[model samples]
Target: MSSTLYAAGRAARQSGDLQGLIDAVPYARFLGIRSAAPESSALLQLPFREGLVGNPALPAIHGGVTAAFMENAALLCLLLRLDVLRMPKSVDFAIDYLRSGRPLTLYADAEISRVGSRVAHVSVRCWQDQVQQPIALARGHFLLEPAPESA
Candidate 1:
Protein backbone atom coordinates (compact mmCIF):
# COMPACT_ATOMS: atom_id res chain seq x y z
CA MET A 1 0.00 0.00 0.00
CA SER A 2 1.12 3.54 -0.59
CA SER A 3 2.07 5.72 2.34
CA THR A 4 -0.54 8.23 1.23
CA LEU A 5 -3.20 5.55 1.50
CA TYR A 6 -1.95 4.50 4.89
CA ALA A 7 -2.23 8.01 6.17
CA ALA A 8 -5.59 8.53 4.55
CA GLY A 9 -6.89 5.28 6.04
CA ARG A 10 -5.66 6.32 9.42
CA ALA A 11 -7.41 9.64 9.09
CA ALA A 12 -10.58 7.95 7.91
CA ARG A 13 -10.45 5.55 10.83
CA GLN A 14 -10.30 8.41 13.24
CA SER A 15 -12.81 10.59 11.47
CA GLY A 16 -15.66 9.76 9.12
CA ASP A 17 -13.66 11.00 6.16
CA LEU A 18 -15.26 9.31 3.18
CA GLN A 19 -13.09 11.10 0.64
CA GLY A 20 -9.98 10.11 2.54
CA LEU A 21 -10.95 6.46 2.33
CA ILE A 22 -11.70 6.70 -1.36
CA ASP A 23 -8.40 8.41 -2.05
CA ALA A 24 -6.58 5.56 -0.34
CA VAL A 25 -7.14 3.29 -3.31
CA PRO A 26 -5.03 4.03 -6.38
CA TYR A 27 -7.53 2.46 -8.73
CA ALA A 28 -10.35 4.46 -7.18
CA ARG A 29 -8.39 7.60 -7.94
CA PHE A 30 -7.88 6.54 -11.53
CA LEU A 31 -11.60 5.87 -11.93
CA GLY A 32 -12.52 9.21 -10.40
CA ILE A 33 -14.59 7.45 -7.77
CA ARG A 34 -15.86 9.61 -4.95
CA SER A 35 -17.27 8.56 -1.59
CA ALA A 36 -20.07 10.14 0.38
CA ALA A 37 -21.73 9.54 3.73
CA PRO A 38 -25.39 9.65 2.95
CA GLU A 39 -28.01 9.89 5.66
CA SER A 40 -28.81 6.20 5.38
CA SER A 41 -25.88 4.57 3.61
CA ALA A 42 -22.42 5.08 2.16
CA LEU A 43 -22.53 6.12 -1.48
CA LEU A 44 -19.92 5.92 -4.24
CA GLN A 45 -19.80 8.05 -7.35
CA LEU A 46 -18.05 7.32 -10.66
CA PRO A 47 -17.64 10.25 -13.00
CA PHE A 48 -18.17 9.65 -16.68
CA ARG A 49 -15.17 9.64 -19.01
CA GLU A 50 -14.84 8.85 -22.69
CA GLY A 51 -11.98 6.45 -22.01
CA LEU A 52 -14.24 4.25 -19.91
CA VAL A 53 -16.42 3.43 -22.87
CA GLY A 54 -15.92 -0.15 -24.00
CA ASN A 55 -17.98 -0.02 -27.20
CA PRO A 56 -17.93 3.06 -29.35
CA ALA A 57 -21.14 2.09 -31.06
CA LEU A 58 -23.10 1.66 -27.87
CA PRO A 59 -20.91 4.10 -25.96
CA ALA A 60 -21.18 2.08 -22.82
CA ILE A 61 -18.85 1.79 -19.89
CA HIS A 62 -16.82 -1.40 -19.72
CA GLY A 63 -18.37 -4.19 -17.71
CA GLY A 64 -15.05 -4.79 -16.01
CA VAL A 65 -14.83 -1.18 -14.90
CA THR A 66 -18.31 -1.29 -13.45
CA ALA A 67 -17.49 -4.49 -11.61
CA ALA A 68 -14.28 -3.00 -10.27
CA PHE A 69 -16.16 0.06 -9.05
CA MET A 70 -18.72 -2.05 -7.25
CA GLU A 71 -16.04 -4.13 -5.58
CA ASN A 72 -14.12 -1.08 -4.47
CA ALA A 73 -17.30 0.46 -3.10
CA ALA A 74 -17.86 -2.62 -0.97
CA LEU A 75 -14.28 -2.54 0.29
CA LEU A 76 -14.59 1.12 1.18
CA CYS A 77 -17.81 0.48 3.06
CA LEU A 78 -16.12 -2.32 5.02
CA LEU A 79 -13.12 -0.19 5.79
CA LEU A 80 -15.32 2.55 7.19
CA ARG A 81 -17.13 0.09 9.44
CA LEU A 82 -14.08 -1.91 10.52
CA ASP A 83 -12.22 -1.17 13.72
CA VAL A 84 -8.81 -2.04 12.34
CA LEU A 85 -7.13 -0.25 9.46
CA ARG A 86 -6.20 -3.24 7.33
CA MET A 87 -6.63 -4.11 3.69
CA PRO A 88 -9.30 -6.68 2.90
CA LYS A 89 -8.45 -9.27 0.29
CA SER A 90 -11.20 -10.45 -2.03
CA VAL A 91 -11.83 -14.18 -1.83
CA ASP A 92 -14.58 -14.33 -4.40
CA PHE A 93 -16.46 -11.81 -6.52
CA ALA A 94 -19.56 -12.19 -8.66
CA ILE A 95 -21.33 -9.56 -10.72
CA ASP A 96 -24.65 -9.50 -12.55
CA TYR A 97 -25.05 -7.08 -15.40
CA LEU A 98 -28.61 -5.90 -15.45
CA ARG A 99 -28.35 -3.30 -18.21
CA SER A 100 -25.81 -1.53 -20.36
CA GLY A 101 -24.01 1.28 -18.57
CA ARG A 102 -24.35 4.41 -20.64
CA PRO A 103 -22.00 7.35 -20.61
CA LEU A 104 -23.13 9.00 -17.40
CA THR A 105 -22.09 9.45 -13.82
CA LEU A 106 -22.68 6.19 -11.98
CA TYR A 107 -23.40 5.67 -8.32
CA ALA A 108 -23.09 2.68 -6.01
CA ASP A 109 -23.85 1.58 -2.47
CA ALA A 110 -22.84 -1.54 -0.55
CA GLU A 111 -24.72 -3.62 1.92
CA ILE A 112 -22.54 -5.80 4.16
CA SER A 113 -24.62 -8.91 4.68
CA ARG A 114 -22.35 -10.63 7.15
CA VAL A 115 -18.97 -10.38 8.81
CA GLY A 116 -17.39 -13.46 10.31
CA SER A 117 -14.15 -13.82 12.19
CA ARG A 118 -12.08 -14.05 9.03
CA VAL A 119 -14.47 -13.44 6.19
CA ALA A 120 -17.01 -10.81 5.19
CA HIS A 121 -19.75 -10.80 2.57
CA VAL A 122 -21.04 -7.69 0.84
CA SER A 123 -23.67 -6.93 -1.78
CA VAL A 124 -23.25 -3.94 -4.04
CA ARG A 125 -25.51 -2.20 -6.55
CA CYS A 126 -24.58 0.30 -9.24
CA TRP A 127 -26.95 2.65 -10.98
CA GLN A 128 -26.80 5.60 -13.34
CA ASP A 129 -29.64 7.92 -12.34
CA GLN A 130 -32.16 5.93 -10.34
CA VAL A 131 -31.40 3.29 -7.74
CA GLN A 132 -34.42 1.28 -8.84
CA GLN A 133 -32.84 0.88 -12.24
CA PRO A 134 -29.47 -0.66 -11.55
CA ILE A 135 -26.84 -1.28 -14.17
CA ALA A 136 -25.00 -3.99 -12.26
CA LEU A 137 -25.19 -5.90 -9.01
CA ALA A 138 -22.27 -7.55 -7.22
CA ARG A 139 -21.57 -9.80 -4.29
CA GLY A 140 -18.10 -10.33 -2.87
CA HIS A 141 -16.41 -12.26 -0.11
CA PHE A 142 -13.32 -10.76 1.47
CA LEU A 143 -10.73 -11.98 3.91
CA LEU A 144 -10.49 -9.76 6.92
CA GLU A 145 -7.24 -9.61 8.88
CA PRO A 146 -6.14 -7.57 11.84
CA ALA A 147 -3.67 -4.81 11.28
CA PRO A 148 -0.12 -5.21 12.53
CA GLU A 149 0.56 -3.67 15.94
CA SER A 150 3.85 -2.18 14.77
CA ALA A 151 2.02 0.27 12.57
Candidate 2:
Protein backbone atom coordinates (compact mmCIF):
# COMPACT_ATOMS: atom_id res chain seq x y z
CA MET A 1 0.00 0.00 0.00
CA SER A 2 1.14 3.52 -0.70
CA SER A 3 1.66 5.92 2.17
CA THR A 4 -1.52 7.78 1.28
CA LEU A 5 -3.58 4.61 1.24
CA TYR A 6 -1.99 3.41 4.44
CA ALA A 7 -2.89 6.63 6.17
CA ALA A 8 -6.40 6.50 4.77
CA GLY A 9 -6.84 2.94 5.94
CA ARG A 10 -5.58 3.81 9.39
CA ALA A 11 -7.94 6.75 9.64
CA ALA A 12 -10.84 4.60 8.43
CA ARG A 13 -9.99 2.00 11.04
CA GLN A 14 -10.15 4.58 13.78
CA SER A 15 -13.32 6.25 12.55
CA GLY A 16 -15.12 3.16 11.13
CA ASP A 17 -15.48 4.78 7.72
CA LEU A 18 -15.45 2.76 4.51
CA GLN A 19 -15.56 5.61 2.00
CA GLY A 20 -12.05 6.70 2.80
CA LEU A 21 -10.78 3.22 2.22
CA ILE A 22 -12.79 2.90 -0.99
CA ASP A 23 -11.70 6.26 -2.32
CA ALA A 24 -8.08 5.35 -1.68
CA VAL A 25 -8.39 2.60 -4.26
CA PRO A 26 -8.35 4.08 -7.77
CA TYR A 27 -10.10 1.16 -9.41
CA ALA A 28 -12.85 1.21 -6.79
CA ARG A 29 -13.50 4.84 -7.53
CA PHE A 30 -13.53 4.26 -11.29
CA LEU A 31 -16.00 1.46 -10.86
CA GLY A 32 -18.18 3.61 -8.62
CA ILE A 33 -18.32 1.03 -5.84
CA ARG A 34 -19.73 2.14 -2.52
CA SER A 35 -20.62 0.50 0.75
CA ALA A 36 -23.74 0.83 2.80
CA ALA A 37 -23.39 2.81 6.02
CA PRO A 38 -21.39 1.01 8.66
CA GLU A 39 -24.51 0.75 10.80
CA SER A 40 -26.21 -1.11 7.95
CA SER A 41 -25.30 -4.51 6.58
CA ALA A 42 -21.94 -5.01 4.91
CA LEU A 43 -23.37 -4.74 1.45
CA LEU A 44 -21.36 -3.15 -1.38
CA GLN A 45 -23.18 -1.45 -4.23
CA LEU A 46 -22.20 -0.90 -7.86
CA PRO A 47 -24.52 1.67 -9.29
CA PHE A 48 -25.70 1.35 -12.86
CA ARG A 49 -24.16 3.43 -15.61
CA GLU A 50 -24.05 3.29 -19.40
CA GLY A 51 -20.29 2.95 -19.33
CA LEU A 52 -20.56 -0.33 -17.47
CA VAL A 53 -22.73 -1.98 -20.06
CA GLY A 54 -20.88 -4.73 -21.88
CA ASN A 55 -23.45 -5.83 -24.46
CA PRO A 56 -25.84 -3.44 -25.98
CA ALA A 57 -28.14 -6.23 -27.09
CA LEU A 58 -28.27 -7.82 -23.67
CA PRO A 59 -27.56 -4.53 -21.88
CA ALA A 60 -25.53 -6.38 -19.26
CA ILE A 61 -22.74 -5.30 -17.03
CA HIS A 62 -19.34 -6.47 -18.21
CA GLY A 63 -18.15 -9.76 -16.82
CA GLY A 64 -14.83 -8.25 -15.80
CA VAL A 65 -16.58 -5.49 -13.88
CA THR A 66 -18.74 -7.99 -12.07
CA ALA A 67 -15.70 -10.04 -11.12
CA ALA A 68 -13.82 -6.96 -9.98
CA PHE A 69 -16.78 -5.88 -7.85
CA MET A 70 -16.89 -9.25 -6.12
CA GLU A 71 -13.16 -9.19 -5.53
CA ASN A 72 -13.43 -5.71 -4.11
CA ALA A 73 -16.19 -6.81 -1.80
CA ALA A 74 -14.08 -9.68 -0.52
CA LEU A 75 -11.05 -7.47 -0.01
CA LEU A 76 -13.10 -4.87 1.82
CA CYS A 77 -14.58 -7.55 4.04
CA LEU A 78 -11.12 -8.75 4.99
CA LEU A 79 -9.95 -5.22 5.65
CA LEU A 80 -12.90 -4.55 7.95
CA ARG A 81 -12.35 -7.75 9.93
CA LEU A 82 -8.57 -8.08 9.98
CA ASP A 83 -6.18 -6.34 12.35
CA VAL A 84 -3.64 -5.24 9.79
CA LEU A 85 -2.62 -1.89 8.42
CA ARG A 86 -1.52 -3.03 4.97
CA MET A 87 -4.07 -4.28 2.47
CA PRO A 88 -4.09 -7.98 1.68
CA LYS A 89 -3.07 -9.26 -1.76
CA SER A 90 -5.20 -11.56 -3.81
CA VAL A 91 -3.77 -15.05 -4.31
CA ASP A 92 -6.44 -16.47 -6.55
CA PHE A 93 -10.05 -15.83 -7.38
CA ALA A 94 -12.62 -18.10 -9.00
CA ILE A 95 -15.96 -16.82 -10.20
CA ASP A 96 -19.18 -18.28 -11.52
CA TYR A 97 -21.50 -16.24 -13.68
CA LEU A 98 -24.92 -17.56 -12.88
CA ARG A 99 -26.85 -15.23 -15.16
CA SER A 100 -26.61 -12.13 -17.30
CA GLY A 101 -26.12 -9.12 -15.05
CA ARG A 102 -28.87 -6.67 -15.77
CA PRO A 103 -27.95 -3.01 -16.01
CA LEU A 104 -29.10 -2.10 -12.54
CA THR A 105 -27.65 -1.28 -9.18
CA LEU A 106 -25.84 -4.43 -8.16
CA TYR A 107 -25.19 -5.48 -4.56
CA ALA A 108 -22.65 -7.87 -3.14
CA ASP A 109 -21.87 -9.34 0.27
CA ALA A 110 -18.83 -11.38 1.20
CA GLU A 111 -18.57 -14.14 3.75
CA ILE A 112 -15.28 -14.92 5.36
CA SER A 113 -15.01 -18.65 5.00
CA ARG A 114 -11.78 -19.15 6.94
CA VAL A 115 -8.94 -17.11 8.33
CA GLY A 116 -5.63 -18.80 8.99
CA SER A 117 -2.42 -17.26 10.21
CA ARG A 118 -1.49 -15.81 6.81
CA VAL A 119 -4.34 -16.69 4.48
CA ALA A 120 -8.00 -15.78 4.34
CA HIS A 121 -10.71 -17.35 2.22
CA VAL A 122 -13.73 -15.32 1.15
CA SER A 123 -16.85 -16.01 -0.86
CA VAL A 124 -18.99 -13.29 -2.41
CA ARG A 125 -22.52 -13.35 -3.76
CA CYS A 126 -23.86 -10.65 -6.10
CA TRP A 127 -27.44 -9.85 -6.90
CA GLN A 128 -29.60 -7.01 -8.09
CA ASP A 129 -33.10 -7.65 -6.79
CA GLN A 130 -33.25 -10.96 -4.95
CA VAL A 131 -30.58 -12.35 -2.67
CA GLN A 132 -31.69 -15.90 -3.37
CA GLN A 133 -31.14 -15.38 -7.08
CA PRO A 134 -27.59 -14.26 -7.40
CA ILE A 135 -26.17 -13.12 -10.74
CA ALA A 136 -22.66 -14.22 -9.81
CA LEU A 137 -20.71 -15.96 -7.06
CA ALA A 138 -16.99 -15.82 -6.40
CA ARG A 139 -14.43 -17.33 -4.05
CA GLY A 140 -11.09 -15.74 -3.41
CA HIS A 141 -7.96 -16.48 -1.44
CA PHE A 142 -5.91 -13.65 -0.03
CA LEU A 143 -2.42 -13.40 1.44
CA LEU A 144 -2.58 -11.48 4.70
CA GLU A 145 0.21 -9.73 6.51
CA PRO A 146 1.97 -11.89 9.09
CA ALA A 147 0.95 -11.36 12.68
CA PRO A 148 3.63 -9.87 14.86
CA GLU A 149 5.14 -12.22 17.39
CA SER A 150 5.41 -11.36 21.07
CA ALA A 151 8.79 -11.34 22.66
Candidate 3:
Protein backbone atom coordinates (compact mmCIF):
# COMPACT_ATOMS: atom_id res chain seq x y z
CA MET A 1 0.00 0.00 0.00
CA SER A 2 2.95 2.30 -0.01
CA SER A 3 2.89 2.50 -3.79
CA THR A 4 3.62 5.86 -5.41
CA LEU A 5 2.94 7.04 -8.95
CA TYR A 6 5.86 8.27 -10.98
CA ALA A 7 5.17 10.79 -13.71
CA ALA A 8 6.45 10.32 -17.24
CA GLY A 9 9.67 12.14 -16.44
CA ARG A 10 9.76 10.92 -12.89
CA ALA A 11 8.90 7.38 -13.92
CA ALA A 12 11.16 4.92 -12.26
CA ARG A 13 14.44 5.03 -14.15
CA GLN A 14 12.95 2.10 -16.00
CA SER A 15 9.36 3.03 -17.06
CA GLY A 16 9.89 5.79 -19.58
CA ASP A 17 7.69 8.72 -20.62
CA LEU A 18 4.32 8.20 -22.25
CA GLN A 19 5.93 8.74 -25.64
CA GLY A 20 8.80 6.57 -24.55
CA LEU A 21 6.44 4.15 -22.89
CA ILE A 22 4.44 4.48 -26.07
CA ASP A 23 7.49 3.90 -28.19
CA ALA A 24 8.63 1.15 -25.87
CA VAL A 25 4.97 0.29 -25.64
CA PRO A 26 5.83 -1.77 -28.66
CA TYR A 27 7.49 -4.11 -26.22
CA ALA A 28 4.01 -4.71 -24.90
CA ARG A 29 2.07 -3.77 -28.01
CA PHE A 30 4.23 -6.15 -29.97
CA LEU A 31 3.02 -8.73 -27.55
CA GLY A 32 -0.37 -6.99 -27.67
CA ILE A 33 0.07 -5.35 -24.24
CA ARG A 34 0.24 -1.86 -22.76
CA SER A 35 0.79 -0.77 -19.14
CA ALA A 36 -1.69 1.56 -17.50
CA ALA A 37 -1.08 4.89 -15.76
CA PRO A 38 -1.00 5.61 -12.02
CA GLU A 39 2.26 3.82 -11.68
CA SER A 40 1.59 3.12 -8.00
CA SER A 41 -0.53 0.18 -9.07
CA ALA A 42 -0.71 -0.54 -12.78
CA LEU A 43 -2.26 -2.91 -15.26
CA LEU A 44 -1.11 -4.09 -18.68
CA GLN A 45 -3.83 -3.93 -21.36
CA LEU A 46 -3.51 -5.43 -24.83
CA PRO A 47 -6.03 -5.12 -27.61
CA PHE A 48 -6.84 -8.08 -29.78
CA ARG A 49 -5.54 -6.23 -32.80
CA GLU A 50 -5.76 -7.93 -36.16
CA GLY A 51 -2.04 -8.21 -36.83
CA LEU A 52 -1.32 -9.85 -33.51
CA VAL A 53 -3.94 -12.48 -34.01
CA GLY A 54 -2.48 -15.88 -34.48
CA ASN A 55 -4.30 -18.65 -36.29
CA PRO A 56 -7.09 -16.25 -37.09
CA ALA A 57 -8.31 -19.41 -38.63
CA LEU A 58 -9.06 -20.29 -35.00
CA PRO A 59 -11.20 -18.40 -32.51
CA ALA A 60 -8.62 -18.12 -29.69
CA ILE A 61 -5.57 -15.91 -29.33
CA HIS A 62 -2.23 -17.63 -29.44
CA GLY A 63 -1.20 -18.88 -25.99
CA GLY A 64 2.40 -17.76 -26.55
CA VAL A 65 1.36 -14.19 -27.31
CA THR A 66 -0.83 -14.02 -24.22
CA ALA A 67 1.95 -15.38 -22.06
CA ALA A 68 4.25 -12.67 -23.40
CA PHE A 69 1.82 -10.06 -22.13
CA MET A 70 1.87 -11.66 -18.71
CA GLU A 71 5.65 -11.43 -18.64
CA ASN A 72 5.59 -7.74 -19.58
CA ALA A 73 3.10 -6.93 -16.85
CA ALA A 74 4.97 -8.73 -14.11
CA LEU A 75 8.32 -7.28 -15.12
CA LEU A 76 6.97 -3.74 -15.41
CA CYS A 77 5.57 -4.09 -11.89
CA LEU A 78 9.05 -4.80 -10.60
CA LEU A 79 10.35 -1.78 -12.52
CA LEU A 80 7.71 0.45 -10.94
CA ARG A 81 8.41 -0.89 -7.45
CA LEU A 82 12.05 -0.04 -7.71
CA ASP A 83 11.17 3.56 -8.59
CA VAL A 84 12.85 2.76 -11.91
CA LEU A 85 15.99 2.38 -9.88
CA ARG A 86 17.17 -1.11 -9.30
CA MET A 87 17.26 -3.46 -12.27
CA PRO A 88 16.07 -6.84 -11.07
CA LYS A 89 16.32 -10.04 -13.02
CA SER A 90 13.68 -12.70 -13.24
CA VAL A 91 14.88 -15.89 -11.65
CA ASP A 92 11.79 -17.85 -12.49
CA PHE A 93 8.15 -17.45 -13.46
CA ALA A 94 5.09 -19.68 -13.27
CA ILE A 95 1.95 -19.03 -15.29
CA ASP A 96 -1.42 -20.72 -15.38
CA TYR A 97 -3.65 -20.35 -18.40
CA LEU A 98 -7.17 -20.31 -17.08
CA ARG A 99 -9.10 -19.31 -20.19
CA SER A 100 -8.78 -17.85 -23.67
CA GLY A 101 -8.14 -14.12 -24.09
CA ARG A 102 -10.65 -13.25 -26.73
CA PRO A 103 -12.47 -10.28 -28.26
CA LEU A 104 -11.16 -7.74 -25.76
CA THR A 105 -8.12 -5.93 -24.51
CA LEU A 106 -6.15 -8.44 -22.45
CA TYR A 107 -4.84 -7.05 -19.17
CA ALA A 108 -2.51 -7.98 -16.35
CA ASP A 109 -2.37 -6.54 -12.84
CA ALA A 110 0.67 -6.96 -10.69
CA GLU A 111 0.25 -7.54 -6.98
CA ILE A 112 3.06 -7.40 -4.50
CA SER A 113 2.93 -10.52 -2.40
CA ARG A 114 6.21 -10.45 -0.47
CA VAL A 115 9.53 -8.62 -0.57
CA GLY A 116 12.34 -10.62 0.87
CA SER A 117 15.82 -9.19 1.36
CA ARG A 118 17.24 -10.82 -1.77
CA VAL A 119 14.18 -11.58 -3.82
CA ALA A 120 10.79 -10.02 -4.52
CA HIS A 121 7.72 -12.02 -5.22
CA VAL A 122 5.02 -10.63 -7.52
CA SER A 123 1.69 -12.03 -8.58
CA VAL A 124 0.01 -11.03 -11.85
CA ARG A 125 -3.57 -11.63 -12.95
CA CYS A 126 -4.58 -11.21 -16.56
CA TRP A 127 -8.14 -10.62 -17.66
CA GLN A 128 -9.75 -9.56 -20.86
CA ASP A 129 -11.54 -6.31 -20.01
CA GLN A 130 -13.13 -7.94 -16.94
CA VAL A 131 -11.30 -8.18 -13.65
CA GLN A 132 -13.71 -10.77 -12.23
CA GLN A 133 -12.99 -13.32 -14.93
CA PRO A 134 -9.30 -13.74 -15.56
CA ILE A 135 -7.72 -15.43 -18.54
CA ALA A 136 -4.48 -16.23 -16.76
CA LEU A 137 -2.44 -15.83 -13.57
CA ALA A 138 1.31 -15.55 -13.04
CA ARG A 139 3.81 -15.40 -10.20
CA GLY A 140 7.44 -14.46 -10.53
CA HIS A 141 10.61 -14.45 -8.48
CA PHE A 142 12.95 -11.53 -9.17
CA LEU A 143 16.52 -11.56 -7.96
CA LEU A 144 17.59 -8.16 -6.61
CA GLU A 145 21.10 -6.86 -6.50
CA PRO A 146 22.12 -3.89 -4.40
CA ALA A 147 23.60 -0.81 -6.06
CA PRO A 148 27.34 -0.54 -6.08
CA GLU A 149 28.70 1.60 -3.25
CA SER A 150 29.14 5.08 -4.71
CA ALA A 151 32.26 7.09 -4.05
Looking at model 2, how many pairs of residues clash?
0
Instruction: Please list all clashing residue pairs in model 2, or write none if there are none.
Output: none
In candidate 2, stretches whose alpha carbon ends up further than 4 angstroms from where it belongs are 146-151
For model 1, residues 4-121, the per-residue Cα lDDT tens digits are 6556666776776678778778778888888655432469899899988999899899998898899999888887776445678899999999999999988999989999988999
Give lDDT: candidate 3, residue 97.
Answer: 91
lDDT of each: 0.83, 0.84, 0.65
Local lDDT at 41 for model 1: 46
TM-scores for all predictions: 0.88, 0.88, 0.74
lDDT of 2 by residue, 43-145 (tens): 8899999988999899999999999999998987777666655678999999999999998999999999999988999999999999899999999999998
Error of 1 at 7 (Å): 4.8
How displaced is residue 6 in candidate 3, in Å? 12
lDDT of 3 by residue, 53-84 (tens): 66666667788877777777776666555533
Model 2: lDDT of residue 99: 98
